[model samples]
Target: MTLTGVTVQGRLNLSQQHLAHGLLFRDCHFDDGVDLRGAVCEELIQFVGCELNDLHADNIIARKGFSVVDCQLRRVSFASAQITEDLRLSKSRLSHEVDHVALHGPNMVIEKSLRLDETWITGEVRIPFSHVGQDLDLRSAHLDNGAGLALDATSVIVGGQLRGDDGFTARGEIRLCWGRMSSISFRAAELHKPGGVALRADSIHVSLGCYLDQGLTASGTVRLVGAQIDGELACTASTFTSASGAAIEAERLVAKDVYLDRGFRADGVVRLVGAQLARQLTCTGGHFENPAGDALDLTGITCTGSVYLNQDPQHEQCFHAHGRVQMCGASIGESLVCSSGLFEFPGGVALDADGLNAVGDVRLNQGFRAVGRVRLSRATIGRQLDCGASSFVSTENPALDLTGLVGHGDVLLTSGFRAAGQVRMRDADVSRDVDLSTAHLEGTGTKVFDAFGLRVGGTFTFQLAQPPKAEVDVRFADVRRLNDSPSSWPTRQTSMEGLTYQSVSNIPCSGRIEILQGTKAFSLQPYRQLGKVYREASKTKEEREVLIAGLRDYRNRGKLKWPQRMWNLFLEHTVGYGYRLWRPFVIALALVVLNFPIYHTAEHHNLMESVGAKESQEHHNVKHCPTDFPCFNPLAYSIQLFIPVSNLHEVDKWVPDATRGWWSTFLLGWTWLMIIIGWLLAAALGAGLSQAVRRQ
Candidate 1:
């Protein structure tokens, strides 16, 4: 029977009514709450064509089917209802209730569709372990709960968010085609198959103001198909463990600030193509892996803030943000890519990728390795880049792929830059031979590539290395830049040694090479041709001098002279202690020589001896002396003999007279002391002058 617009208040038992036809509750008002508990109705149960007032049906048992499509349930309850066929609750408004619950089908089984799209349920919805045979669509449904919503199912084709206040724990395959969740979570849920979760909402807010303890975690595949968020997202203490499918696929997710504190593990591709992030997006301990495919594929994403992906020791390439992450033209605040082992974001700018740039800072931490080339070509930025302890392993490809990076401040690649910071191949096992054979390096104003400790697998080259070589280290081309004056550029710099033609097979440099002032020589022919293409100026006289000197040193030592030429090539550049020991004596000798009369006089020696004797004697002996001795009587006889010997050179008068001989000897000693002092002063001055000249 098709009933309509009628109130069935007391004992409306439809339990024995199996396979019932369409029953309607049109515009009926019940005094108390209606009870259709454990009722077996076959056909659709419609409240659509009615306005019901106070219809309370807790545990409305429907054995076969129950349809509330376009129905206005005034105050209805289906806490633990069981239905067999389709449960269509679309376009329904169940507002203003005590418990704030809309539909409760805990262990119900619906063979047909379960549509709840565009419905406004101002309560709670508990659909745990409910089995839906077909698609379960809940698209565009707003569930404002006082508590939360819990709809976890094992056998259900869910195509929406089981969203609520407290949390949403779904272990089944919840297909979020286009969903918005607030203060919810799907922690440790597994959904790695195709057609998984998609975030197409313009802005998905998971804000729990004072309830900051909650986290919205997605351990399975969380695919984002062009989603945008303008709020802060904290994935703190969350795990995204996916091995094949995208762990978190934000194709175009525009966010303000997104922090990934706990960690992200992706065994498949985690792409973020054409997304714009304004504030800081930190990936603190995220892991990205692709055992069967590419690991972290962030193809085209523009972040205006810092993005840090530091991996722990357990995972190797577990941290990778691939694709083109641009920060050049955009307004990125800061960028930091810090980790151990290999941390690659190839084809992206240091601060800007694909013309999107940062107006801030860029830091690459120690032990950071990039196998492929890092291309920041045609990208403009205003920042200080620090790649100090980083490493670029171009074994699979060219090491540093900074083809077009327009930096305003400093570009520090003090880490090892192999080859010529260009096409790193040849003797090296670079993935592919590079071709920086043609590129313009403006030496007028810009501070160029700086590679301090570069190591090459094979023969390194710097064909595209530029002038002011102090700022660059090109291992390929030639050591021609050494001849040029050191750079007066604003930044602290180092000289470039182009190692291009050094390890070339077959063709040897046949011409005579020369270097001046301890500089090294380079192959002229290959470099000359290369320089022509780069519009490099012809070799200057200073450069020629440096080259010749280097060649001569090399010929003598049977090796290329490094950092030193012929003059002091064998000696150490710094001074030592052997020279220091003789310096004092040399100064005294010089002083005496400058005053020749005093230095060669016998009187000078006698005076010196007397003074030495007086100083050496004991104080008591010098003060209280007897009349005969005038000093110590112990050495009186010896003193008398010494007095005679003091004039021993004039042996004719061999007499011991205390007054005359001692006086003469004293005078000579005084003169000798004066001469010695003069000599010491002269020697000291001479030594100082010599040292100064050498240093200059």
Candidate 2:
């Protein structure tokens, strides 16, 4: 039956009717509505240029297809309807003022496509639990539900692509929760909900891919939480703006790859916490602006390929984030690069990748700037962590924190890298070199570079652009080799105690001494470590110098008792702490030469007498020789008195007499003092000779 320019006064109810031919209404106006409840049509049922109050097609079955093209309706209900072919509602205007839903299509199954191209709906288009065999095309469609859901396709399964691109606009939320589609594309679509969710695709499974890119704009949150996409989830050149909350919440979303790059912008947070991606996550040239909170949060996300938050070379623009860009606990299969990107979160963490595990290099270098702290604490990087030429500026906290990081390759913070606050790498273990050459580090706290307990498998290059103004703590850190300049060493407030290194760069012993002395506290370990390095290199002279300096410093600066201080001083001056073995012999020879004059003066004053002729009370001179005893020679007497084990017997013949005069009394005390001095000198000589023998 075909009706043209016909007017129906009452309801045209076709309930429980079976029609062999399709019904076509052209330019028809119905006063009430058309009801096709429980009706079965063998051919196509079409409505063209028709004006109706409602179209209730509940439980209707169309064998060919269903079409409502270029129609004006207040409400349309196709609940539990089955269409064998395409259901076309193109260029239709559905305005339901009383009801919240303009088109209700729950449990509707379409054999082919569901095209709503250029259609305008004032109320919600509720199509929950619907199944479409082919594409669900909503191109150039306008949906307006005020603040309510504009399009709710929950649990709807589309066998083909679901496209809402090319001027498709939804004023309220467009939900696709629990829906499964082969692919989804919202390119150039505008979804606006202001403070509410604009696009909620929670747990939606897209077999091929999902594209919300190509100038797509979402004013409110675009949530894809628990969504699984077999292919890439790209939002390139898209804009997401949420003033209150996250712009894109994709927690636990599993996708092949994610692209939010090339002029992509998010006004609020773009949270992808716990998201799993089979490939890379590229955010290059994207601008994320959430000043009060995190801008892009990828916490616990796993991506099999590299993550690029760097500059787009073609556009010469970087991935700029105003708030914190957190990637904490993320496991990346390849490198995490943010080269030439600007992350500004002033006073807070700008880029936090703590606990991040990356299989390849992490490049935050090449003009990458973080206004706040860049924390990579506990992160494990498989390849080099190159932060060369990067600038991290934080006034209140550490500028760059790499604590507990395990890096398999070199960590380069070199080549004009600047850190305004402290750069802490405490407990970090790097398998290769950690280069900080030409880097500028300024501390906000006491320590400038705190690498305490850090272990480096290769050389640690600390050749900075300038000396750190604050303390540099490397206490207990184990480094294979150290390449640093003496001028780069912090003059004071350095804590290098227990820091172990196999070798150091070629510097003077005095320069190395300055390093040990520049430590905040006096520790013997620093001295011993320096000495060990010199010893290992077989530089015995430098080793002795270092050891002697260490002893002197310990005596002067270290805590000691008065006796210990005295003993330390004695050992240092006498034998250079047993390093100078010939010093004692020189002192013994000088003492013997000075004692010769004292014995001669005593004999000249008649204060000396032969020991055998003591009863005769005679002075022992060369002229007064005793036959039974040895000759009373002054030189022989002095030699015998000075030598403790000499058998000259001159001391037996001649001795100082104290009973002669006052001068004689002083001479008698001096002669006995010489005997005691002789034994001490002999003992010192024996010790020096014994030390030399042991060394040989």
Top model number, TM-score: 2
Model 2 is weakest, by summed lDDT over 10 consecutive residues, at: 614-623
Estimate candidate 1's alpha-carbon lDDT, on a 0 to 1 scale.
0.43
Off by over 4 Å in 2: 597-606, 611-654, 658-696
lDDT, model 1, position 288: 55
* TM per candidate: 0.41, 0.94
Candidate maximizing lDDT = 2
lDDT of each: 0.43, 0.89
Error of 1 at 222 (Å): 1.3
Tens digit of lDDT per residue, candidate 2, span 6-96? 9999999998899899899999999999999899999999999999999999899999999999999999999999999998999999988
**Clashes per candidate, residues 3 or more apart or on different chains:** 72, 2
